[model samples]
Target chain A: MEVAYLGPIGSFSYRAVKLAFPDAKLTPVATLVDVIEAYEEGRVDLALVPIENSIEGPVNLTIDQLFHQSSAHVVAEIVLPIVQNLLVVDAKRAPEKIFSHPQALAQTREYLSEHFPQASSVPVASTALAAEIVQQHPTLAYAAVANLDAADFYGLVPLAKGIQDVAQNNTRFWVLGEKQPHIALPSTAQKVTLALTLPENLPGALHKAISTFAWRGIDMTKIESRPLKTVLGQYFFIIDLVSNDNIKYACKEMESLGITVRNLGKYCIYEGEK
Target chain B: MEVAYLGPIGSFSYRAVKLAFPDAKLTPVATLVDVIEAYEEGRVDLALVPIENSIEGPVNLTIDQLFHQSSAHVVAEIVLPIVQNLLVVDAKRAPEKIFSHPQALAQTREYLSEHFPQASSVPVASTALAAEIVQQHPTLAYAAVANLDAADFYGLVPLAKGIQDVAQNNTRFWVLGEKQPHIALPSTAQKVTLALTLPENLPGALHKAISTFAWRGIDMTKIESRPLKTVLGQYFFIIDLVSNDNIKYACKEMESLGITVRNLGKYCIYEGEK
Candidate 1:
């Protein structure tokens, strides 16, 4: 199957797709939208996008895109450990500036602050692209925070390895496709994803709507609220719940409480451990 | 009063500071950390940082920095309308490449996709920096998405205006200070902010935590989860509730239910009219 990912080849998303499908035909797209568009146009069977990172939190654009384009289904998820390295043009270059993707740069701010306090940190579109820039401007006295694979791909040398502040830095990627997976159910599997909106600007309106899930003993794994572009103070909640029982009853109860609940899909457990 | 913002004069954060306190002494810092550091160092009475945007959602670094520092309190908030413009060297320059801050670039993606479909988009450290790059390399045919002020500062002309797809786009900026304002009584404040964490990975842990506020008729204004950075499964929730009641009781109840609750600070209610 053809799998799409965001990249210039050496991105974490590219590595994630390779890890998940191993030998799948991989197409690297420039933006997350490109991946979604490719999947929508049937250019690829599945696409991987980074949803959240342990250090940087949720990638808001990815979440918004998921909500905006309701056609795709999150078929699988993968957590990739992120290791940011300071790649330089050459060992001889005395780097006065560092470049990296915005997220990566933010993730390694503490390290950059503590170590290279004098160097100016620049944000780039992508880490691989930063490496490419360093390769093109070999005498520019610049370094980039990127993966070792990217450094190797762009013929750059490592200035420093594992520069991220946190050793436990990891990012969770969602695999989106046209159809949900058809895996045999496991007894331990118990989760549901739902997107819903509350009634109006009434006091405690959202609380009342979400109460149904709580009262029914359903555990919320994730609950994110995005402003409904149409009206002020209105939002749509993308919720993930853990419950072996069917969510139909709770969802109905929520709707009865003036919540417009939309069942995106029900799938096997998240299997977060994997 | 002196107000510090993360920037170099024409940065988005600087514009936010200007929007909030027009006559205040605006100190431009190199980084967001510097903004916070200036506040901590008593160099600035107030600091403005972009917290969230309509197009980009929350700025994770700002949130994490706030959480990590914890010394400052969010005294006030402002939502500024963001209008990004494409500034180029000249019409004859017919820029084949574009540069912008990652967030600005992301916000203008749809516009850029439609207008400059084939041009490569690069992310610069900041909008002002992008403008500066265009100024220094006028013959390189590079355009930047920045504010009108930034374009003027760099002697560039607008190639396109209001390039963001969302017309009513706005970014929420928080004014953080060393001490919380002593507002004698909570006004008809419809929103309260709190930071808390779940007890454990139990089946209905979050459900129980959220039920306390919901069952008590508290409307949730916002709910965002961030990884605590302590453990794999642990997460911290930054929530805004609608209530003028004593939040201490809610905090106590949440703690009683084995949840860890921290009262960050509460200010006047957000009108949501903006």
Candidate 2:
């Protein structure tokens, strides 16, 4: 299968796509939209996108795209451990400035504060791009927080390692495609993803809709709403159910109560076990 | 009232906070965590943090912080339109590169792709900081996408104005405080907020919980869920309802169904007219 992932070949998302489908032909895109567009345009059989990071929470871009594009299904899921290092152009630089992706910088704020007391840190769009900037600048006084692969690609030397506040940092990626992969056991799988919205503004309408799930003992894994963008008050919801069958029933019940329901498909169960 | 906001002054969050609390004392912090910490330490009576943007969706850092710190209440909400401008130190300087906050850069990707095809765009943590970078590196042919206030502060001229692809781009900020504000309404308000979690490994539990709200005819304004972090599959939801009474009733019903209900407080209706 041909797979599309975000990158310049060394990005974490690229690694994730490879890890999940090792033998698949890979295509790299610069943005999430490109990846989705590639999938929608039939350029790739499947696309891998980062959905959430353990430290950063959900990636809104991916979620928004998933909601907007109705054709793709979340076919598989993968969680990859993230390790960031502060790489520099020279060992004796005593870097006066550091650059990294905003999320990476946020994750390593405490470490940077404590260790690089006088250094000014700036955010970049991506860790790999930050490394590329440091290399192109010809400044030994700058460092970048990125993965080892990014450092190698940009010809930077590791200045410090394991800078993230949480040592167990991990990012979760979802594989999206037109066809849903068949899971071995549908009963054993524990999570179901659904997208829905309520009818026009009516007093006490949302409380009544959610009660259907709560009343039936369906555990919601996730529930996020975005404005319909057409009307001021209308909003749409993306919810995840603990059981696939439970979700089917819940969707039926929700529709009966005038709440529109759309199942986005499911992936491997997160058993909550390490 | 004294309010704390994230910024170096002239930042989007700062403007949003000022717009929300016109007569209040606004304290600017470099980070959102500082804004939350100030409120937690009682240094500020309230805090305003950006929660989501129309183009970008939710601000995961602020949302994750809300989940991380359970004591704060979201007392009010405000949505402000965002217009990004490309500012440069010298108009004559050939724009070889551009810099901006990641969000700003992402929001203006189409503009950059069309207008500055050859320019390399760099992302920073804040627009104000990006403006500062341009000022410091005046000899370099660089520009930044920032608000007019930031351009004026850094003495940069606007190379281009309102470059964002989405004209309806807006950001929503949550006014957080130790206690919910008691705003007496001339008419009954139409918004309520709640936090909830379902029982462990329970099938169809979430569906049952939400069904109560649906049955009560309450319209949901917003609904979002975050992983508990402590457990992989466990999640907690942050929901907004049309009426406090309806949400209260739905909570009672959910609790009876064995769902853990946490009331994060409610606020007056947000019509977005202001």
Candidate 3:
């Protein structure tokens, strides 16, 4: 199997991909768009992308592209507890510039403000990319907020560990593939993901749509609303429901109400070590 | 009146603030957190912040800081049609780098990928800051994705205009203050924004909460799920409802179902010229 992920290598997505597909050949791409493109263009068997973080909410780029630009199905999920660390080439030197992916920068905002109040923070494409930049600019007083894996991979020193604002900073990554798994899914399979587009200007369309599963005793783990990208007030709901035999019936009932339901995937979730 | 906004000036938020309070004394701040802090600490009479965008959905930093850190109420809103432009110090020079706020960068991602595939895009604190950086470094081949206001403010040439991915790229900015408007709101006051926290692990809690307003014929203009920041799969719904007399009753009914609803504010909306 071949797997593609957003990376310069040593990113959280790379870690998740490694844990999920230990034997697969890994292809690291530069951006989330590239990761999806690699899967869509048949360059890789699967693509792993971060969908949400406990601290930052949903990754809008991934959600927007997943629903609007691609038709791939999510085959698996990995929940990784993110522990951001400050990496540097020379730990003794006080850094004047800090860098990381925007989300990582946000996760460590409080720490940065409290400690390095005068340092300038820069956002990059990925945390590992920040590490690479910091590694290459050894003479500059620069630091990166990334995972320990990045520090190890780039031979940078971890000046500080677990600098995220919150203690439970978990990020969820989805492995996207071209086809669904067989009907006899593993017993661990517990969640079904659906993207629902409700008809416009309807008062109770969203309520009615959720009721279909609610009335059936199905538990919804999450419900996120993203813009349909057409207008300001218009949105489509991305829902995560406990996998059940009655999901199809609920989807059918929703369809009858003029709600366009797209089954993105039904897959099991695995927890990654912190 | 004194107003604080996220700016070095010439930002979209600055434009919205100028339109909303043309006569007020404006105080430009560096970050969204500083804007809220200025309001909370009584440094400004009102603080203007970007709440949501048509293409990017909700502004997570603003939402999180508003609900979690402060108790201010949203007093008014301004919807501005965003038209991103490529700003350059030298129009004849081919740009090797692009810079903008992360939101602006994402908004113009498609345009950048199509027009300048080889240019490196840098994310900055604000679009105005990007224009400032580009202005100060005339020797470097750098461009900024910002509004016409920014380009004019920084004396930069507009290499391209209306370069956003979508035409309907509107952003909603909220003016937050300490007190409720004297109870006699204007006729244009049409929206009430609420943040609701549903009790843990309860099936249909969200459905039940929405149904309170839905069954009463109240139209919810928007519903966005944001992380509660406590754990994975937990969320708080930020709901925008069309202002109505029955909204209080709906809140009572939701409270009866054990939902914790925080009334952020009920405010009128204004539109800025494109």
Candidate 4:
């Protein structure tokens, strides 16, 4: 299989792809926007994109692209526990400056504040980009916060491990493409993503929309709302349901009530090794 | 009054402040996080922060900070139409690279793709930072997508004006402080921000929570949901109601039904000159 992910060989997306499909040929891209563009153009068979982190809520561009750009469906999801570490090179003493993506810096805030309060923090595009920069300037007193894979890929030594403030740091990644996943299922598709839009903005519009799931006792794993961009108060809601059967029922109920329902594909999420 | 705004000087927040308070003393800070930190520490009498753009929805850090860190209320708001300009030090040479904040870059995607398809784009912390970099390195073929004030502040010439894809680009800014606004009002506040959390996650919890407002004909101007951070699938709903009387009625109803509701603030939004 051919797969594309956010990488310079050692970002978290690279790790996610590795864990989910160990034998796939990997293509690395620079930006989230590029990933979607590449997938839409059929440059890669599958694109692995980070959807949300437990600490950071949601990755903004990924959400925007899923809403606005993709014709592809989410075939599967991979949940990876994030382990942030402080990696440095040739530093007999503490580094004066540290670099990482904005989300990484935020996740390790408490650790950095306690260990190196005086150090300056710089945000680059990604954790892999930070690791790459630290590699180019080997003589400078600089460090990075990234996954364990990045330290090995960039040839840096770990100064510290598990530096994230909250212990339960995890990210859920999606596999988007034309083909659906053949692995990790319980005979029934375990999850379904639905995008719904209201015909008009009214006081009870949202209440009526989600009640379809509530009335059926379908467990909604996630619900996110974004503005329709037509005017000030209009919005579209993305709902994640636990069962595909529930999705079928809800879509029919919603459409009958004049709400527009767009099914964004249904597949089982990868639940890790047996 | 002394106010803090997101800046390196001459960013959109600066423009928002100038329009809202014609005589207040201004102090520029680097990030949305910094602006709140400065405000909480009592270093500034007021902090002006961007809440949502008509295009970009809500600024994440601003929403997160106002939810987690502040005791301050939103006293007033300012709405400004955004006009992004491509500022270059010298229009004589074709630039090889362009820089701007990620949102600014996203807003001008069509313009960049059409005009400079071959140019590499760099994402900086702010649009002002991008302008500063282009100014300091004049020999490098670089340009920035920033406000008109940034072009004036950095002594750069405009390569283009109002290059945003959408003709109706606008942003809404909040004035956060301890006291209520003595400025524009109808003798009673028109808007009130409410943060509500459910006692537990259920299929229809959100449907029920929102129905309190829906049943009353309360016009919701905005509603944003963020993960509660305590667990996955749990969320806090930030609801912006248009009427103060409606907020009182809804809060009473929600509390009676065993839902938790926290009033963030009640303030009038600045409806510019007649």
Candidate 5:
């Protein structure tokens, strides 16, 4: 089995792919688009990308591509509590520049503002890139807000362990694959993901959109409004809720109510170590 | 009147601020947090920040700052259609670097990838800073993906106008202030935004959350689930829809349903131009 993820070498995404598919051959790609493109083109078996973060709401790029533009199925999900460390060359010296992914920078925002108020921050492609760049330029007093895995991979020492301001900073990664899982999931698996597009621009269309599920006493766990892309103010909703067979019924019911619905996947949420 | 906005100068936020309050004395701030902080601390009369984009779902920084972190009320909203241009030092040569705000960069990802595949894209603080830096570094072939206003302000020439992949890439800006408008708003100013917290972790809490408004035939324009920031999977919902005093009644009903609700604001949507 082959897995492609958004990476340089050792990103949080790399950590996610590793935890989920320990035995699969891993391939690091430049962008999230590249990961999905590779999968769509049949170059990879699965494409894994960050979908949401506890600190940052949702990875719009991944979500937009999945809902508005993709043919691949979100077959599985993995929630990893992001463990970020400050990797630096000179621990004693106050660094002038801090580098990391935007999400990493945001997670450690409070810590950075409080500790290194004067230091300038830069956004890189990934945390792995930050580590790689910081490692390559040893003369500059540059620190990377990245995972310990990245530090270990790049032979860098942790300046500060768990530097993220919020301890509960976790990112949920979605597995996009052409083929569905051959093995049956556990009965305890409950979450079902659906993307619904309205038939017309009716006044109460959105209110009615949720009514189908709500009337059935189904829980609406997460709801996101994304642009239809064709017109401004028009949106398609991406909803995640707990269900088993009721999910299929709800989708059919929504379709019957004149809404175009897509079952992105029916998978269990990751309940692993934090 | 005074207004605080994200700036170095000449960014899209700057454009929105100018469009909304053409005569207001604008005070450019360093960050969205700063703008909100300035407003909360009474340094400025109003704070203007991007709330949503047609391409990108929502401005997480502004939304997060306003909802979970601030006490200031979001009083008004202005929607401006983004007009981005390809700014260049030289039209003949392909630039090696493209600079812009992360939002600007993301919006022009398709155009950049296709036209300047080899040129590395750098994320700056704002579109204004990108234009400023690109202007100062004429020796280095640096181009900026910014608005036409920035190009004119920085004395940079536009390589291509309306270069955004999507033509209707509009952004909605929220006005944060201490006091709500004194005068009575027109009845057509019906969109009301609310932030609601569930009292307990229940199966149908979310379904119940929206039912208060949905059951009453109120149109749900937009519903977004944002992280409560206290817990990982826990969320506080932001709902916007067309309503009058019915929104207040719905809020009361939601409270009756044992949910903690915050009236973020009752403001009219920008309806100037498409």
Candidate 6:
């Protein structure tokens, strides 16, 4: 199957896709929107996009795009441990300029400030692009903050490993496909994600919506709010629940309360090596 | 009093600060972090930062910074009606490149794609800076998506107004001060924001936390989750509640459940003209 992912190749998303779909034909797309669009337009059978980071929280662009466009269902989850390494062409030289995706730069902010106090941190499109840029500019004292795969792919040396501020940094990626995976049988699926729209002008609307899961003794892994974009205060809540029989009932209860419930996915987690 | 805000003089934060604290001495900082740091260091009495937008949900940088570094309280909220106008140096020719901050570009994505599909969208630091750049390169067919104030400040003519995808585009700014505003009294405050950290390894921990509000009949205006940065699954929930006497009791109940609660602010909302 052909798969689309945000890449210049050797990105964290690339690593995730490679781990999850090892034999798939990988098509490197420039942006997150393009990845989803490729799948929606049937350019690829599936697409991989980073949905959340342990350090950076939700990937807003991915979530926003999913909310606004695309009818694709998440078929799989890939949890990859993120290690932001300092890569360079010459290890002995102190870099005067550092390049990275803004998220990586933020993750390594403390480390960068402590080590490369004088270096200017430039925000590029992606970590892989940062690696490519640093590799292309060998004459300049430029370093890149990227993953091991990026360093390997771009032939850059890892000047320092795990330069991120936190040791437990991990990113969760979603595999989006037009067709729901047959593996989503209740016996196999471990998680269920739903987008909930609460009825308007109702007092305690969100509270009542959460009550459906709470009273049913269901365990929710996450509940996040995104703007509905129609008004200032209205929102759409994206919820994740531990897969259980009660999820079906809870969704029904939510719908009974006039909350529009859209089942985004019921998927199993695939953890990549640390 | 002096105020620090993210700016190049005509940014949205600048406009928010100008509207909120009309006579204050304004210091334009380079980034959101700098705006907060300036206030924390006593260089400025207060700082104005964009916390949320109607179209773009929360401002991650501002929210993350507030959760991690600042001890400052949100003294007040300023809701400003955002109008993304297409500013041009010369309107006779079609633009080859369009410039705006990424958020603005995203807000105007549909509009841009429908109108200027041939033009490349360039992500700049801020919409005001985009306006300035377009003004500086007057000979080129360049357009900027920015506010009317920026166009006025940069002397660019408005090619189009309200080019955002949605008609109800509004941004909420927070005024952060080291000391709590005397106006925070229950009698005057309309909202209270709290950052809650749920106890570890507890089933339905989030639900139990929300129960504090549900049982007490309190109304919540917003609920958003941010990663605690320690692990992949752990999170910190930021909640906004309608100001009421029961807020104190709710905090006690949350603490009783072993949840760490930090009161970000109890303040009033100020709405800017549409």
DockQ scores of the candidates: 0.43, 0.42, 0.39, 0.37, 0.36, 0.39
Please report, in order, the local distance difference test score of every candidate based on alpha carbons: 0.72, 0.73, 0.82, 0.76, 0.75, 0.80
Candidate 2, residues B1-274, lDDT tens digits: the string is: 7889887776887666655666778899766777888988999899888888522223766776777764788887776668899999888776888888656777799999898899997756568888898999989898988888788788999998999876765677778886665432222364677777778755666566667776776665677777776776567777777764666777888888888887666765342322
Record all residue pairs in model 4 with backbone atoms less than 3 Å apart, i.e. clashing. none
Tens-digit per-residue lDDT, B17-136, candidate 5: 777777888898755677788988888888888786522223766788888679777777777778778898777777899987655776788988888899998865457778888899
Q: Lowest-lDDT window of 10 residues in candidate 3 chain B?
A: B180-189
- Which runs in model 4 stand beyond 4 Å of their true positions? A53-60, A182-189, A201-203, A271-274, B53-58, B79-82, B166-172, B182-189, B201-203, B271-274
In model 3, the Cα lDDT at residue B189 comes to 46
Which candidate achieves the best lDDT against the true structure? 3
Stretches of candidate 6 exceeding 4 Å from the true structure: A8-11, A53-58, A124-129, A152-155, A178-189, B53-58, B124-136, B152-155, B178-189, B201-203
TM-score of 5: 0.88
- Please, what are the lDDT tens digits per residue for candidate 1 over residues B1-274? 7888877767767666665566777888766667777888888898877778522224766777778665677776665668899998896656788988766877899899888888988766568888988899977889999988888788999988889877766677777875543322223343457777776755566666677776666667788777777787567888887655756677788888778777656655322223
Docking class of 1: acceptable
The best-first sequence of candidates by DockQ reads: 1, 2, 6, 3, 4, 5
- 1 versus 2: better TM-score goes to: 1
Write one digit per residue (lDDT tens) for candidate 3, span B1-274.
7999877678888777777777789899766787899999998898989876522223866898899899999988788888899999999998999988666787788899899999998866567778988999999999999888888899999999999887876687888986543221223447999999999856689889988988899987677777787766678989999999999999999888889989999888877774
Task: Kindly list the per-residue Cα lDDT of model 3 for residues A12-49, writing each as its tens digit.
Answer: 87777777777788898766777899999999888989
Question: Candidate 3 — which residues are off by over 4 angstroms?
Answer: A53-58, A101-103, A113-126, A179-189, A201-203, B53-58, B100-106, B109-126, B179-189, B201-203
User: What's model 4's TM-score?
Assistant: 0.88
RMSD of 3: 3.8
> TM-score per candidate, in order?
0.86, 0.81, 0.88, 0.88, 0.88, 0.87
Candidate 5 chain B weakest ten by summed lDDT: B181-190
Residues A143-262 of candidate 5 have per-residue lDDT tens digits of 998887788898888888888876765578888875554322222355788888887745466666687787777777789888777876688889988765676777787777889988
Question: iRMS values in order, in angstroms?
Answer: 3.4, 3.9, 4.0, 4.1, 4.1, 4.0
For model 6, residues B1-274, the per-residue Cα lDDT tens digits are 8889877677777777787777778899765677889988999998888887522223766887888888889988888778888999887888889988666776788898898899999865457768888999999999999988888899999888988876765688888996543321123237999999988867677888888997898888788887787666678999999899999999999898899999999888877665
